[model samples]
Each structure stands twice: as C-alpha cells, then as structure tokens.
Target: MKKTKKLFGALTLTLLLGLIVGCGSSGEDKNSADSSNKGTTDIQKIKDAGVIKVGVKEDVPNFGYMNPDTNKNEGMEPDIARLIAKELTGSEDNVEFVGVTAKTRGPLLDNGELDMVIATFTITDERKETYNFTTPYYKDEVGFLVRKADKLTDTASLDGKTIGVVQSATTKEAIEKQAKELGVSFKYQELGSYPELKTALTSKRIDAFSVDKSILTGYVDDSTEILKDGFSPQEYGIATKKANTELNDKLNKSIEQWEKDGTLEKIYKKWNLD
Candidate 1:
C-alpha cells in the first residue's frame, strides 16, 4: 500500500512539473511575440517592401499635378518624389503615387499607405510632432489673385471678401494665422483640387484664390493681378511617418547634395519657379 501511494505522488509531481514547464514556455513565446510586434518602424518596412509609395496632389500645378495632355503625372514635387524613390530603390521606376487630398495626406502617412508624401506639405512645429519633415524644398508666401477689373488691389483689400484655399494647405493655415493676428477674418471656402479652385476664381465664384504667389502666374492671365505685398510666409517640405527618421536623414543628405551641386536650383529654373 505504501508503494501504491508513492507511485501516485510521483505521478502527481511529474504532472505538476510538466505544467510548470509548459507555462514557462508559453510565457516566453508571449514575450517573443511582444518583441516582434514592436520591432519594425516605417523606415525598416519601406526598405523591406522595396517600394516607396508617394502621395501627391493630382491637380496643383508647378508643385504636384497630373498632365492630361500626356496622360501622365508631372510636376516639381512629383519629380522630387521620383528622385527620392530612385535613390532609395536604385531605380525611379518603383514608385507608386497615390493621389491625396489635404485632409488625407497626414492620416495616410500615419496609416502606412504612403512611404513619404511630397504633396506640398507645410512644415510647422505643430505638424512635426507627429511626422518627420525634410528641409524646405520650396518657400512660398500666401497670396491672392484678382481680375484686373476688380477693385481688390492688395492684401489689405481682402477684408470681408470670400477667399479660396486648398483644404489642409500650409497656405491656408498661414493665411488664417495672419488673419487672426491682424484681426482680418474674411469669408472663405475650402477647395479640394487646385484646378477646381482656380476655375472657381476665374468664374468669379470666389473673390480670390489664395496659394503660393509663385504658382499664380500660371493660373491667372494678364487681366488678373497678384496681391503678394505683405503676404504670410510658409515653407513646403516632404513628409513621412515620424518613425521614418533614417530614410528622412538619407534624403535630407541627398537634398543637401542637390543644393551644393546646384541641381535643385537648376530644377527650380527648369520649372520657372526661381
């Protein structure tokens, strides 16, 4: 009978030891999975995926736009995006451009749909907290265009008038910021596409369209005039998920090289933006 009791005790002890070992292994696996889950940032994922997805506007001219004449996308920002992709992937052919709106660019980058966004994103401290931004690729001032026949002659003349701005634009934000500081709030409309916004201005649907003063020459004719005097300043930069710092640094170095080599200035002149 004592032998029987000893055998039962051994069996129970063995089962308890097996259970303890199983629990330890399960815990180790859980920890491993936790570490794996925390492992990859956006930059690593981009290198792994081997494709840089770019988000660009399809309608803003000079900066980002699609050409119907060629049935392809073309613009300064798109060209810059292609350059970044080529540098990263050893060929510019690997880029996938997703047309983005002002409201979509931030959330899209946050969600990993885009590797970087070169859609005329404005750099500000408020935005920098969540996303990494490259150095100023372009500097602009928010200004408006009015028909030569219109009585609106200057920035000071925009009081109580309705103005147009692309939604989520730095130009829009700067205008509003300056408006608040100057206590010169005007009625305004948020536009989705630059083409559509420019059309509205030409059709006299809005008193004026406000964007980079540099881009105004393309949209307005000799019958129109720009109110650039005392306009608010803003900077445009490429955007990426905040975790994409390494890739950001690489491209920043590339931009610095471009500046040093005068390649960027050449591009600016090619686009007639300089």
Candidate 2:
C-alpha cells in the first residue's frame, strides 16, 4: 500500500514539473516573438533610441545649409527635420543632422545610414519606386542662374552654353528636357557638390548654374540673374525607405498638422520663401 502511495505521489510530482517547464517554454517563445516584432519597426526603434538621424543638404542655403557663424545647420529643410524629430521624440533636439549632397543622399538613405532625408528631395515616379516620400512640403521650379554679363534672357538663350549642375540630381534631365522642348542645345558639366557648381558659375567656368529656383536664389547676387521663366515644377518631400508605411503615415500626419496650424507657412516666411 505504501509503495502504491509513493508511486502515485511521484507521478503527480512529474506531471506538475512537466507543466511548469512547458509554461516556461511558451512564455520565452512569446517574449522572443515580441522582441523580434519590435525590432522590425523603425518607429519603435527610433522611440527606443530616442534619436533620429536625418540627411540634409549642407550647401543649399535657405533650404539646408551650414551657417558659418553658428557652425550648425540652419534653413527651411533643417527646421522641418527638427519638427519631425519633435513629433517623434517630443523634442526637436533629439535629431542628428548628417550633411548629404545630391550625389550621396540616396545611397546613404538606401544603406540605412540615415533614418530620413529632408534635403530638398524632389518626389518623382522613379524615386517613388525606391523610397517612400511624404506629401509635398514645398513646391519649386527649375531655373537658371547666369552671369548678368552674359545677358541671357531665357531658356532658349542657353543654347550652346555650358551649364553646371550637381550630379545625381534631376536638374540635368530637367534642363535637357526643357532645352529639347525649346529646340536648343547646351553642354552640361556635372559637379559633385552645389558649392562646386556655384563656384563654377562664379568663375565663368560654366555659363549658367541650373537647379531649383529656391536654391539658386541663395547664390544669386549682383553678378547673377535667374531666368524669369522656369520649368519642371517640383514638389519636395521627406523621404524614407520604401514601404515604411508606419513612418510614412506618421510623417504625413505631422505635415498635415503643421499645414493646418500655419506652421508650414511660418517656416516659409522665415526662409523668405513666402
């Protein structure tokens, strides 16, 4: 009888131990799944890290540029990036700015070197296939900045002229398309950076510098004049990796809120874009 009792007790203890071990295994698996899911989302990761790294232009004044006196990025694009960081992290200071040129920004973002890009990135059907972009924050037109001495009055006058443009930008294509429509021919010189192109224009190495009018405005002075009529209407947007639906939705919401509250208008006015 005692042997029977002992056998029953052992069986009960074994069953209890088995149940405990099974429950523990199930709990561990659930935790592991949760962690894996959390890591897959950029918004959650950014929230966990408490900072967002943004790519921005360093030479295009009034859009994104490094102020010499402050030695910090200051411009409409930077301001908009800060606003995004603020929306995500509850503080504008939670952002780290990475200087990116037209030639580098796309690759940097593609390789996960940047969390987002706000470098006056113009949205196009081709780019949309590679990345997600928020609604247009700013609208722009492509224009030409020529030495006032050149006396070039319109796009047609750029025939046979050498024009400087930043590589990897849509500027060259836009210019060529416009020239084709106008039945003119021009030579293109691709530079690695905006400052280099601006220098080329100033030094007479290129007869004209071509880009978005807002950007050209920053470099214009007594020596240069922007063509009155511009082409290639552009809509600039903040960009992230393709199919980042959650981040895209959040950014779009933030942009909508800003637009409704006149925050966007204020920023435009601050940059003299109004």
Candidate 3:
C-alpha cells in the first residue's frame, strides 16, 4: 500500500514537471519568433541590404529627370538623393532611383518598393498622417506655363480656359482656391506626368501647363512663358514610410546641416534651379 502511494505521488510530480517544461518551451518559442520576425527597423533594414531605394520623378527636369544621353537620373532631387545615400550607406552609388509620379510615389512607398521618396513631395498636414516628411528642403509656388500666343498674361485671363495639372499634385487645389478668391474660374485636366502636361499644352489640348514655377521653368520654350502670378507656396520635403521615424529623423538632420552650410544652395545652382 505504501509502494502504491509512492508511485502515485511520483506520477503526479512528473506530470506537474512536464506541464512546467511545456509552458517554458512554449514561451521560449514565442519570444524567439518575435525576435526573428519583427526585430529589424526600417533604417536597419536598409543598412542590412546595403542600399537605399529612392523614388524620384523621371520627367521633371532640374528637379528630377532622366537624362536620355547618359541614361541616369540628373537633377536637384537626385543630387539630394545621392547625399542621402551618402549619409546612409557611406557611398552615393549605394542608392537606386525608381521613377515615380505624384500618383505613384505614395503607393510605392507604402508597398515597400522604395525606402523613401524624394520626388518633390509636398508637405501638408493631411499627408503628414500617412507618411513622415522632413523639414522643407525647398520652397516653390504654383505657376502657369502657357503659350505666348494664348496671351494668358495674368490669372484673370485663365477664365474659361483649360489648365493641365499633374495627377495627385496639389496645383489643382491651389489654382481652384486662388481662382475662386480672384472671382475667376477655369476647367482642369489631370495628366499622368509633367511631360504629358507639357505635350498637352504644346498640342493645344490644355491651354496651360500649370505646376510649381520651378517646374514650369523646365518646360518653358520659345512658344511658352510662365505667368508672373503664382500661388500656393509649396514646401518640398523628403518623405518616408509612416513607420520610418528613424530614417525621417536622420534625413531631417542632414537637411538642417545642409541648409546651414549652403549645401542645398549648391545643389540648386548645379541644376540651374537657383
């Protein structure tokens, strides 16, 4: 009878020990999974990959453009991307530039196809909620590039005219608000790119190719001229995924340093943007 009692006690003790061991093993596995699957930070992930992918406009000359001759992106924004790459991976060549339009940059960033977007992204309160933007590296205002023959001498002349703006760009809003205040109105046509808007203007489809003045500067030819009037001061900033605070902070630091040291001015001058 004592033997029976001893065996039963042993069996109970073993079961309790097994339960404790199983629980401990389960906890260890859960911790290991969390460490392995969710451990890397956004910037750390870029560092681990040894490259930083950036979205840039391939058509907006001087801001971000694809140079047909060299088949490389060359512009103020691409130069800025190079600087960021230097800051991140210790070499400017460690950066890759993917062409993106206003409508596409956000999705590319969201889908993790790009690490950051330096594609003349404007900073606004609404956009701030969806992505992290650094302090404004450049400021510009919306303007109109109309054919000289159209004689669009001022904003008032834009009444009853069709203005072309890039899709997902803020220029349309700027124009509408200003036009309303000025007691004038116009029609709007949205295009996929700056070049498309320019072509539309050249082909007489859109009366004016309207965008930021600096961008307008890129499309002006003998037939086209920018109106003296401008509106909606746009503050351009580098944008990263909403969850990438580390990269955003790092970029802001770089922009601040550049602003202080005139590096940004140098880049602007290099691209004839100043």
Candidate 4:
C-alpha cells in the first residue's frame, strides 16, 4: 500500500511540473513572436523596397509640373520628394513620382499605391482623421483668376457669378464660407485640373478660376488677373497613410531640419517660388 501511494504521488507531481513548464514555454514563444514583429514597421518596409513612391501634382507649375522640354517632373514638390528619397534610400534617383490630383491622392494613399503625397495637400482637422500630415512646408491663400475684362476687384463683385474650383479641393468650402459672411452668393463649377479651370475661364464658361494664389500664378496670362482679394490661408503638408505614423514622423523631422538649415528655402528659390 505504501509503495502504491508513493508511486501515485510521484506521478501527479510529474504531471503538474510538466504542465507548468509547457505553459512557461508557450508564453515565451508568444513574447518572442511579438518581439520579432517589431522589425516589420512601415519605415523598415520602405527601406527594404529600395524605392519610395511619392504622389505629386504634374499640373501645378513651380509647385509640381511635368516639364515638356525635359520630360521630367521639375518643381518645388518634386525636389522635396527627391530629398526625401535620398534620406530613405541614400539616392534621390530612387524616387518614383506618381501624378496625383486632389481627387486621386487620397485613394492612392489608402490603397497602398503610394507611400506619401507631397502635392499641394491642404491640411484640415477633418482630413487628419484619415491620414497623417506633416508640418506645413508652404503657406498660401485662396484667390481668384478672372479675365481682366470682368472688372471684378473683390468678393463683393462675385455675387451670383460662377466660380471654378478644382474637384475635391477645399477652395469651394472656403469660398462658400466667405460668401455667407459677406452676404454674397456665387455659383460654382468644379473641374478636374487647373488647366481645365483656366480653359473654362478663357472660354467664358466660368467667371473666375479659384485656387491658391501661388497655383493661380502658373495659370495667369495677359488676359487674366489674380484678384487682390485673398482668403483662407492654406497650409500645405505632406500626407501619409494614417497607420504609417512612423513614416510621417520621419518626414516631419526631415522638414524641420530643412527649415532650420535653409534647405527648403533654397529649393523654393531654385524653383523661383520664394
């Protein structure tokens, strides 16, 4: 009887010890997996890809434009994109620039088709929920490009007039708010590109083409003039996927460094944007 009792006790102790060791090993394995996952961050992925995909405007000159002569994207934003590529991949040539408009840039970033957008993306509190935006690299204000014959001087002259704005842009909202404040109303024509808006203005299809003053500079000709009235001071920032906060932080740091060291100022001057 004593031997039987001793054997049963030993067996029970062995089983308990085995269970404790198995549970400890399982926990350690889980922790190891979690630690290994840290290597798969967004920045790490960008580094491994050897190229950083950037979305930029191919229409807005001086900010971003596809130069017909050189068949290359040349402007302030593309230059900034190259700098970012150099920082990430150790070569400015490692960047792939995808042309993006206001309507498409968001979708491209959401679908993982582009890593970042350096277009003239205006930062708003509502948009911040969907994407992370870096600190402002440029500041501008909304203005109107109208035919010199219109004799329009300010918002008050635009009552019941049609204003052309880019599709999916904030210009309409800014204009609408301003209209209400001044008790003036205006019709709006939404277009896909700045050139289209300029064409509409030239054709008398719209009374005015409205966008950032800097962008309007590219479209203005002898027949057109930018109104002295400017509103809605816009802050342009680089946007990234909402989940890619690490990449956004890296970009913000780079922008800060550029600003402090006058690198951004030099680029702006190179493009004659400053």
TM-score against truth, every candidate: 0.86, 0.87, 0.91, 0.88
Candidate 2 steric clashes: 0
Error of 2 at 57 (Å): 0.6
> What digit string (tens of lDDT, one per residue) describes model 2 on residues 80-171?
98988888888999999999988789999999889999998999999999999999999999999889988889989889999899889999
lDDT of 4 at 216: 95
Deviation in angstroms for 245 in model 1?
1.9
What lDDT tens digits, residue by residue, belong to model 1 across residues 104-137? 9889988878888888787889999998888888
Report how far residue 168 has shifted in candidate 1, in Å.
2.2
Off by over 4 Å in 2: 1-31, 34-40
Which residues of candidate 1, in runs, are more than 4 Å off?
1-11, 23-44, 177-185
* Per-residue error (Å), model 2, residue 159: 0.8
Clash totals for all models, in order? Answer: 0, 0, 0, 0
Q: What is residue 124's positional error in candidate 2, in angstroms?
A: 0.6
Between candidates 3 and 4, the one scoring higher on lDDT is 4
Ranking by TM-score: 3, 4, 2, 1
Candidate 2 matches the true fold with a TM-score of 0.87
Q: Cα miss at 218, model 4 (Å)?
A: 0.4
Q: Write the per-residue lDDT of candidate 3 for residues 24-59, one digit (tens) a residue.
A: 999999999999868787777888999999999999
Which candidate should be chosen as best, given TM-score against the real structure?
3
Give me candidate 1's TM-score against the actual structure: 0.86
